[model samples]
Target: MNQTTNTVHQDVEYWLKNIVVGLGLCPFASLPLKENTIRITAFLGTDTEELLGFLEQELTTIEKSDTSQIETTLVAVPNCLHDFYEYNLYFDSIDRLIKINQWEGVFQVASFHPDYQFSGTEPSDRENLTNRSPYPMFHLLREDSLEAALKHFPNPEDIPERNIQCMEKLPEKQVNELFYYLFNKR
Candidate 1:
């Protein structure tokens, strides 16, 4: 891999390990992560069409790969989607593509960006940090896997609330260190 690709992949992995798994944001993530079943792919393009194409390819790859070998895929786009608004708007197209391809029930995309903010929350809200990442990326997951995990998890519906609480309880120094990307843009 080139230097840029290596850096992007490393950053995504660090965020996954430190922020996502370490903080217990997603309970199911630990197994796939520890088992080395997570795949991280970088897209150095700035165009949405090209990104969509990349997404399509990754989606197909995950669909065909064995779940035991490739449980999930993270498509990191560091060259574009710098603006949260633009990134947020692109989800419509993603949903349409999923519907058009008839993969709605089989696959799903979870978004994480450096500047992710949930509805009804201010940009500085700690709860927004729940979905924030080192860069703009699409987390492609299998519906079957998610359903199975949720079935085994106690009170699966409270995961988001628990994550928000986790973020809210983070020490300032740790937040500044782990989420430097958000402060860098300010």
Candidate 2:
């Protein structure tokens, strides 16, 4: 293979390995489907071009995203304002941008997490959710598959404190499954 091909291969593999090892889950794990399938879409976002630039640069290292293997898509947004994306077009634009960069991932962008412009909601409470001013929630999978291990892995607290609060409600085996799903195959 040529130097360019090797570089792209290494880049894509780097993404896969980081997601699998660093996050304790394969990047592919985020793409789980119902009934032991992979979700095509996963969520990720950043507050500034700094973070987005990092992800984009890393992803660009890959030759292609290979979305054809996925049943759905993996949507990543930059500048996650108001805890989510505001317009479908904006997110869709993100998806397009990913494809344009030569990554072979698949995903459809949605407009959830509205402006959070409601009345009567506590300022502190709302602020808690939006403390960072902008948040990014990943919505992976074509249908609904919360059963997947890629439950709630946002950009923060990923350092593995070993006391994940959500682990309580779930069973031991289920938690293991999640860990394996997210942690294995790095």
Candidate 3:
């Protein structure tokens, strides 16, 4: 891989390890990540159509592969959909693709962007960091795996609330430093 791709991978790993798992944003993330069942593919395309194409390819790849080998896929798009609003708007197309392909109940799409913001939260709110990643990504997850995880995890309904509480309790300096490191702005 090229230097840029290598750097993006490293940054993403840091975010997954330090921010997501470390902060307990997604309690279910750590095991799959540690087991190497989560595939992180970097797509360097800037066009929306091209990115969608890549997403479809990833979905198909995971769909066809054995779930034991590949539990999930994270398509990292550093070049496209940098703007959170645009990224949010693009979900319609992703949903349509899933519908057209009739992959509902089989797989689900989750989103993560650098500037992700919750509906009622302010731009600077710490809760937004829960959904933020080093780069914009479309997470393709298996419904069966999700169900299995949820079944094993106690009170899965409280995860979001717990994550918000964790974010709210974090120091401002630490949050800012995490994002700065994620984007490599230092």
lDDT of each: 0.91, 0.35, 0.84
The local distance difference test score of model 2 is 0.35
Q: Write the per-residue lDDT of candidate 3 for residues 16-91, one digit (tens) a residue.
A: 8888888878888899888888888888867899888888999999989996689898888877787888998999
TM-score (C-alpha, index-matched) for candidate 2:
0.26
RMSD per candidate (Å) reads: 2.1, 13.2, 2.2
Off by over 4 Å in 2: 1-32, 39-45, 50-70, 73-80, 83-99, 102-107, 114-186
lDDT of 3: 0.84
Candidate order, lDDT descending: 1, 3, 2
Which pairs of residues have clashing backbones in candidate 3? none
Highest TM-score scorer: 1
lDDT, residue 175, candidate 3: 76
Worst 10 residues of 2 by lDDT: 126-135
| Model 3 Cα shift for residue 73 (angstroms) | 0.9
When 2 and 3 are scored with TM-score, the better candidate is: 3
**Which sections of candidate 3 miss by over 4 Å?**
1-3, 182-186
- lDDT by residue (13-52, candidate 1, tens digit) is 9989998999999999999999999999999888899999
